[model samples]
Target: MRATIALALAAALAAATSASGQDLLLRGGPIHTGEAQVEALAVKDGKVAFAGRLDAARRAAPGAREIDLKGAAAYPGFVDAHAHLSGIGFREMTLNLEGATSIEDLVARLKAWDEAHPGREALSGRGWIETHWPERRFPTRADLDRAVANRPVVLTRADGHALVANSAMLALAGVTAATAAPEGGQILKDAAGQPTGMLIDNAMALVRAKVPPPDGAARAEAVRRGAGVYAARGWTGLHNMAASREEVATEEALARQGLLPVRVENYMSLAEGGEVLASGPSRDGAGMVGVRGVKLFMDGALGSRGAALLAPYADAEGTGLIVTPPQVIAQALARARTSGAQVAIHAIGDRGNRLVLDAYQQAFAGDPAALKAARWRVEHAQILSPEDLPRFAELGVIASMQPSHAIGDLYFAPARLGPERLKGAYAWESLLHTGAALAGGSDAPVEKGDPLVEFYAAAYRHDLAGRSGPDWRPQEAVSRAQALAMLTSGPAFAAGREAELGALTVGRTADISVFSVDLLSAPFDQIAKAHAVMTIVGGKVVYEAAR
Candidate 1:
């Protein structure tokens, strides 16, 4: 079945190619083939036939159509190891609060959105961080109510683990001050014990359940729009974490129509792991979509103090909340194991990471060989103790991570987690040195889903402005080469796709990311400012910057 899908996809790409056909010669100044230097590449039937000197490439594919890169550098098309495919599209289509600088800014933006789209049953968006706001606190439900009264509104924090609901939204969810928080969630209350409309982790689901689900048309549009956004930034593929079954079907359906611009590995939500497994591993349409993994959340994020932590947060009064209990994690892992599906669990804090590790171990203990082969991952393996750092490689688990989280979290992590615990936070280098592989991502819609931003964070270990302090942990900074690997091969490994993707090797898909500057040797600022000149997926030019 997999072979059939691969062939079908190749045929689709071949059909898309011009009269020159499937044979092509691509010559560029420098090509980072995830190894030694390469000057040119030959593509045949959407796969790399050769990657070496121009003469050798030409010899390998005689009479092939030629494309001159004109001094641009080529690298493996980047893979976002973790991100929400549908959410990114929705973010573009809905009210975007990513730029709101304060609570007032956020409310103002919501008001403007309300005015623009009057009579909306609900106003939904993401990308607001209260940490950077002048108020330095989450906005209450009253705040949102004041901006757009009567209509329900729910705006997610940048971390995606929490959201502030307007009074109407709260009422729709039937949540009030008297309503107790869920097992692994919180409903922030006022001094007088009135509901604040702030929901964390499981609590957010209450109001979220009431939001109208997007129709098929909306999902299809999101796929098209989001693909273009990633392609423009040079992404050849992305790991769609927490994709619903409907989303998986939507992407596959789009792929069938040759509308999918990039490859997608759909990690369907673990809540539906059984159904995904029953459907089995399959690819369809342009063969640009794959369904073989499940995404599970073990805890919330730190910004909201919902991430399960071993110790109480320095600024908050509690350790953290475990969104998914240990027993549930164990059961999910076991179920995923039976289906031979890869599992990626979201574990953000020390306690969360610890519990997930335990669950994975317990599930894998029964069948050691299966465990070794599963390539199971812990998404956002962000915080950990030194004792648990080595367990990743030891257990053969991949650390699916997002570097953007580090720079964003650095702003307030010091206050949330004291100086002592800071060392174990965002320990990228530490995890690498311990023999664990790191898969880089942006967690898009949660952060700016830009590969350059993620690379800057990993390579520089500082905020976007080059700001860093003792607590920023400069020692964890990785070399640029390492950073690139994290974005490319690292993610490929996590997806179990290193054999065919990640590198510009012979027989691999001709997916390439062309940039204006060499990311490895260029100045830090140039690397940051570097623009993608072109992006090719399966040897087909998906994006080309205007000359």
Candidate 2:
């Protein structure tokens, strides 16, 4: 049967190659059209031209470059609904301590980096989490002081919601035990009333502002490098959360120069997006770059105990901090309604989610028409009150989530929220059942930013090693089909490009991701092992794995 199908596909491609005008043709393996499976697909002028039987596609587009799948499967291109592109690039260029096993290991890595770059005045890095550390606690200033006491050293937690600074950095920032933390932030102190050199949420600005900003050239390079990395990893596009005005300008410049490898939908940070919000959303002519909305934070991340919770943390003292006030969220939503721009707010805890939901409801109530037009998103939506789950659908809010977060956070989430709150933690399927839209993402630099890993995390609901604790709530795992949509159509809908992107239909853009394994039929374990064979964006092949 396989041989027979191959012969037929070859004949169809031969017929297709005879005519002119079509851009490309793909055949030999399954092609998921979002509606049904097809044998072949053809592209023309960057849009899908035909999707059906190989012979039919060939007749429809008789002169296109043929790409044989070679047993691989093709689906609508995957889009990371939430990510930080520049951070991904910076991660590549800077010191990364993502897998440090202990505080000593992290300190040693920092020491090595400091010695290697002795010419630099200050040191900065990110991607360190202490959840699995043997010490079972957050790193302190004394730990980093051992590495580089002379220069300022600031290392951010993996969640980006907090940072631990060396004594030098704390001194440079003028942060001391008497220094009051800004609203919606925390300056962790020792029992003796001394600064611990840990700053959470808004408090991080003190040290961060002291670090010199990167030049325009470096900023542009970061955008270019990040886009290339994502394309090679099978992501056709990304919704860049917390994008700065400078980064948006950098992306546009790269797109204009034809240097960008993948599509980028930018949601600028509230602090830097005043102009974009005033001007409203804008897209490039080629559909490769877009300034879509504003990204706001409702609270910090759960890992750092900064996420605003309704109740005190199970193992800690107080409820997480509210990073943004309800009045501020409401004001942003109102502005977004008038500007015709989407709003994507980061909310990780039950209280944070509730605040955002309430603001969205009030904003919608005032402008029913705007509400219908606005496909506003709640990024992370990691932990939600059971009652607030249904409100997402009621308000037509998009739950922009990262699956890898669930898998990684599960290791420590049980302790952070205890068993009862775990019920609402990472409740993906439950949200889906409530008719809420869930757009999947990787949140790279924080996570690995690999589409395959995200898919595996969502479908299996297990750690990389396939472990799942009893309280991990394996029942929330989504079906493979649902997972696929989350990365494709779901993101497209979230970005308001459902009519143009996402599906492998005749009218949609020719963005397709061909993978080594058939995701729909492969064993759950094999999904993560699968690699991208070919990535097609806007009818152009961006990345192809070496044969």
Candidate 3:
């Protein structure tokens, strides 16, 4: 029965491709429609006009400009299911310390930035991780003081859940040993009971509150720059996580001006999204930007040892912190249900995942229909209790995961959780086997935010260096087809736009991404090295690589 339906759809598509009047014709490569490979595709207005034979597409769109793929691969547009768009732009603008090999290197970069911009009042930078540092410890205030003794220096960790503030900055924030860490936060201290300048999770807000906020102009530019970067990297759209209402407005303004190169679906932060939740979802006139839901954090990231865990960490002492209380999550769920808004909560540890699941189950008490209809998601569903694996599918919750995290975090995760808990860490294939849909993303700024890298990571389950340890669980890696769907249809399904945005079918929006290599057939190692040849959104060419 399904075979007959598929054949009829194919025949209808063939007939449509034989008709006339399209705006663009794409040929000369394998065009994958998530169902079959086609010789050509035609775009009319902003939707797919046809997908079939190359000769028929040429006849159907005689007046259309043709795009020769030159052996590149084309597929339904890739949408990052999770990311921080503005942060990606800010990383470009700020004192980026993304690859500092050691604490001294990080300090040297800070010194260089400080010397280059001597007039600035304070120093702020991000993207430093101590995981691979030779010293094997987080940076300290004393370390940064060597770079800028007089000025306040605050540098955030790569995970965005922790920061190291120099003594000057700590004094400016009035944080001392006597100052108590807020709930769900930690202020690390030395044995002498002095503040060590490392703040985890909620505690980072203390120093951040002291930093000057970016003005409206700066904020707008970040959005613009971030969108351009994503488009250039071949991303057709992104699910912007932790977006502010102001950021949403900025995106809408950009879309109105036709300055936005890629589609944006925002999940505003819970603190700033009350109005949006009450008003329901909204989209720009051109359908380029939309506010789809609200984002909340259940726990901090695993790298910082702040992820709420069921058991104590193998290396650390505690069970980790809970950033948001269970009651708050329950209230948010209830509100989302009433307002018809989706809820995406960040859950990274076993305890965190279980708490979120518990809240969801409680909210879904007697309404099985609403449970599936809500399409609620757990962002970064990274660590989980083996027992709770089936709960995601049973509750109809989406697991919006970033493949790069598995490859990156595995470097230190085994030591943190021990081998006993390794079974449920980044278990992508396990979740899928249990009937849960997994949406893929890069978590940009946090990771490199490159689609090709993300695809490679998902399929290979190894670090960029092509290395993996025994406890890394390489078996959790997905197939090429599954990875492709995660980047396309899975995200569409998660966002409740599957009918209109996921595939290259007639009447669906014409969004396509062309890459240098055939992602499905390329050698695993070569996938990450491939670049984006072109990016198209709504039939408009947003980015094209030069020959």
Candidate 4:
């Protein structure tokens, strides 16, 4: 039966290829329409015109240019529901320490980067996780001083919730032994009360404020470079989770210049929400960019031990820190409500998730209708208590999760949360069954932003190395079809773009992702080998892999 279908598709594609330019006619391979199986698709004026048989598509758009996909499978272009575009760009331009396996290795890499860069005002980079290190200890100022004593340096953890600064950087920020930890942040100190140069949550902001902010030109370039990277990786759209007014301006500038390769739905930062919202939500002419939501950080990440857990960590005495007090979050929600903006809160630990839920509940009391319509999200949603699991669906909160985080954090999550809490960690299938939407992302600069990596992790529920043991909780694994939805329709619905994007339906946007291998049937390990052969957005080919 499959062979007979393949022959029919070949004949149709031959007819399509025999025609000249009109728009686009894609056939000769599997086409996932996000509804049911389809033999082919046609695009006209940046929107799908036909999505059934090739003969019908040709009739719908006569003389359309044809692109035979060969045997590669095509699906709706993947959406990264949450990611940091500027950060991903900066990681490429700066000293990326994600490869360091030990404290010494990190320092050595930094020293080499410093030597190559020559005269920089300050050295700044991200992508280091202490959990994976051989020493399993956070790098201190003294350790960084060994590499460069005269200059300032701040290296962020892969989770982006914590950072380690050199003494020079700390001194510039005026962090001293007497400095008291902020209400929702912590500055780790030594036994004798000296600052240890490790800053978690809001504390990192002190040192960050001292570093020079990138200029407008640099930020514009970063957006361009980042879009290219995502396009090449098969992403047609992303919800840029953190954008300030200046960054949005840069994005608009890039859009005007016709340099953006992917679509962006930007969420203004909670801190800068008022200013960014003054002009109201902005969308570019081509719908390449939209700034209509607000992003808030409720707590730090789990890896830094600052995730505001309901119970104390198995290895530590106290629970984690709440980066943003509930009162502050409530205020942000109130402000966002006035502007009719969607809210996306970063909540990792169970306690963090509870606090955010409580805030959302309070915010929706006066306007229950908004609650259902808002489509608010809980970013990370990494660790949820059994009780809080149902509240996500009940409250209409989308769970914006990153599959790679499961693979990355699962290595040490057992040590941090112990066995019982592990049940709720990165529970993708569990969350889906609870009736909540699951929007997946890479959180690039936090992990390698690859669609295949995210899909593999979601489908297999194991680390890239496949080193999981018996207690690793494979029950949370999602099926390949579910994984694909999390990357496509799930995100499009979360962003309220389901009507226009996320499917190869007639009249929908012409965005598609063609892969070298069929993800639905690929072997677990072979999934990683699948490459994006083509990425199309708005009826234009944005990326095509070299032969």
Candidate 5:
């Protein structure tokens, strides 16, 4: 592995040296440099030499490595601002229920999985959501124990925010009737007040321990495969949201070994133990697996009604739990500020959003210098009050959102939020109008980690499946150009990598994706069909679909 990375680095340097004097240029195609001329690009030393007239590129970067755009709309390499890579990587390894709509269907899939893997003692799988199904109600422990009797079974909810364990699994975790819910989490109980194996928020850890820990090699392999999966779909770089210290180490090793296909913006959290900054900042990470941010969950998700809301969910009388409380926020912020790390907080509900914004505002208001360099992030930003919309730009925080989520969650959001409060939901364009640079993402496993789906949702403001006629907020929809910037320069800025990656201009990394169809001209639905024909990272072809 060391030899391989050395060889690749040597080749990259050789290419940079060879193209030092004479420039490398690509002409004819229209380029979107995010803020500059929409023309050709001249590259030298793997950086953009010049990006202006076609004639200028030819004159400057002569004899340099060149790629033909072939009339395709060229923009900066895409950056998925938020995603669950470990979840995406391991999705195939588990019982995936991304689209299961019925309890019967979910049970059948799990039964089939258990039947196939005979005598596998403990069984695990994911993908069960009562909200999207015809019969919308949370599944109980009996539901799972019935399928796999005595085996310790623990299946994660579609969103990594929660999980459902069987009787045996609960026993293994020592979760009984007397178990008390942890701060920022609740243990769902049966009618008899017994633990039902339905764990939310911090309660998931109780059951998670019973599951075998994935080895470093296995996780590394999973992450590498996950990167390849995204590259094949036109993703040049990605934000690995809420990763453990060990996962970051694995990705770092993979990148150092030249096995990483995608540029990862690693956001760390001290999940079970170890300090994120100490364990990570120890390694500067160069540009491979950069750990400059920390992830904090302010509240739970909207699907499970665990998302903290000012008012109770219209569907459920209970209000959502506030996952990360004030004290926790202050404590984490202290660590982050001291460690010189930016923070990314997950705030989905109104109260959650308000609280996170308030905490950040207080942190900044306390010492303006603290935020100048950190560039904190708020993941999801799913639902927000109009009053709190501009808090992002005001505090210089980035609203790292997943466009696919707006449309995907719309089916049930309105039902829970009611018509009165619906105005504040999925307000992407409003955030932009409020002067916030939106960073686009897929949120992966939670929602399919497809860049195109994100683009469709952002630009068109509609679902690929076409749930609503036009879009939820058609007037608020962002133009393709604006959406492109969110996925590119916006995230680039978020990661503090604007100068190096994102854009395809001179003095920047040569990370590019060539799509089969022109992104600008492709019809709405055709986008989902469009695939990345060629993916180049650091002037090397990482993925190219076979003709």
Candidate 6:
């Protein structure tokens, strides 16, 4: 049957090529290949067989599938370099606190949720951006206690860096005033130094023990939903930032069932599971899924003052937290290096970024050959001390960043860093100028998981609140072309899959995203509404929204 189908496809391709000189000639569309000059593109078997004028493209593959683009635009299928896939799909099922600006709003939302759910065990949710409120601070434990009273409730900040829980939650987790602070974490306390519901960095582990883990079934469904959402947005693939072995297995199962709408590059939490460390990145020899690297969280996020910074936060007056101890990071890097698996270390703060870079530098012996082509990534790379920016390029580390973060976080970053420290935040243009490769991501549930939003932020550097007046040091903003590249070829290069994906070159994989609007010339605000008309992967139409 497979051979018959192939023969039929070949015949169709031959006929199409003979008649029109191409299998699928996308005539006259502005095809941005993440390269210079947005040109026209041609495709065959899901790969760009040729690109340019219609006549030339048709001549290259005569009598092929002819797609009349009618001046519509096309770009590469967005490559989200970092995102917690399962985490996003389940965000709706959890305690969401993304945009509750004030304490009253947060309490109201939780109370409503609690009332609706009735007999639910506890209140677990996310998406509370109280930093922008008139109070401009995190909610205290005393505040949370009033909302839930008895039920153990734990809510995550919008940035996914901090947690706010109630007294019941603290009691349930046995976190008390006597619970001493961990090495790199802090327990929010009252004036008398008693435990509060808020926890930062390593201190989150205190209440984390009480939150029940998602079961196998829930994980499977989350992965399924995540894949659907990705494909719906014209994403042919994703690099699952930090997932466990079970998540990998779930993705593998979905891939086997041919249910996974997008191809996933699964990185592991462990260096080795079985004898597989020596063999290489696959559990059961599935081609769609790959486990090539391990993810390590070096520090927490900046919004929560958990990112390890060189100096203390401009406002908070305290150094950011280092979630993972230096020794642990060092050991992990060494293990990952020897095991021949790539490592993606999450480092958002200056201190965290420097520490991870130092670990990589130390483990790899500063020798290119010793690292074995392992594309070590400093995920987030949000805030870098000026001195450490060059190390990303110098050490051949990939700076995997989420552009949406810049725009979203800009509302409060100025206050966090005052003015002097603002230079180090979301320095994409600086990173690129320094000859470093940038991998763009959404960070999923942390952001909206929208490629257009990321592109706009990368290109414009302005948050929704309109951080106008140069948009937070506009010099550090990347051009639209560069932004597209970061989401496309940059990540492809980081994953070592540039040869197969990323560009509209022949013999490469056929994964494409056809947009309804010209991404290069599209108005900034309208970008969010830009539609993906067609999403083809491996020469098959996975998603096609009719005109």
TM-score per candidate: 0.94, 0.94, 0.95, 0.93, 0.89, 0.89
Off by over 4 Å in 4: 1-22, 275-280
Clashes of 4: 0
Q: Compared to the true structure, candidate 2 yields what TM-score?
A: 0.94
Those runs of model 2 whose alpha carbons end farther than 4 Å from true positions after fitting are 1-22, 366-369
lDDT of 5 at 283: 38
Name the lDDT of candidate 5: 0.75
Error of 6 at 364 (Å): 1.8
Q: For model 3, give the 10-residue run with minimal summed lDDT.
A: 12-21
Write candidate 1's Cα lDDT for 401-449 as tens digits: 8998998888888999899888899999999999998999999989878
Q: What is the lDDT of residue 266 in candidate 3?
A: 95
Model 6: per-residue Cα lDDT over 1-547, one tens digit each: 3243233323322322233212466655787766644455667755778767667777877767666666677777788899888887677556667767699888888888888777647678887877568876788778887677868888888777778888888988998889987877888888898886888877888888888878889887777667766666667778887777777888887666656666788776643333223444553453467777777788888888888878778787787877776787776666666677778888887788888888888897858656536778888998888888888887788999999888777777887767767788899999999999899989888887778778888998877544554437888878888988989998788888888889877677767777777878878766767766666666555655556
**Order of all candidates by TM-score, from best down to worst?**
3, 2, 1, 4, 6, 5
Candidate 5 clashes between residue pairs 3 or more apart in a chain or in different chains: 23-61, 47-507, 48-505, 48-506, 48-507, 49-506
lDDT values for all models: 0.83, 0.87, 0.88, 0.84, 0.75, 0.75
- Ten contiguous residues minimizing lDDT sum, candidate 5: 13-22
Q: Which candidate is the best by TM-score?
A: 3
User: How many clashes in each structure?
Assistant: 1, 1, 0, 0, 6, 29
Least accurate 10 contiguous residues by lDDT in model 4: 12-21
TM-score of 5: 0.89
lDDT of 4 by residue, 482-502 (tens): 999999999899988889999
lDDT of 4: 0.84
Order the candidate numbers by lDDT, best to worst.
3, 2, 4, 1, 6, 5
Clashes of 5: 6
lDDT of 6: 0.75
Candidate 5 lDDT over 37-136, as tens digits, reads 4667776665667888887787777777666766655667887899877777677566777677787787777788888888857887776667767777
- Residue 43 shift from truth in candidate 4, angstroms: 1.1
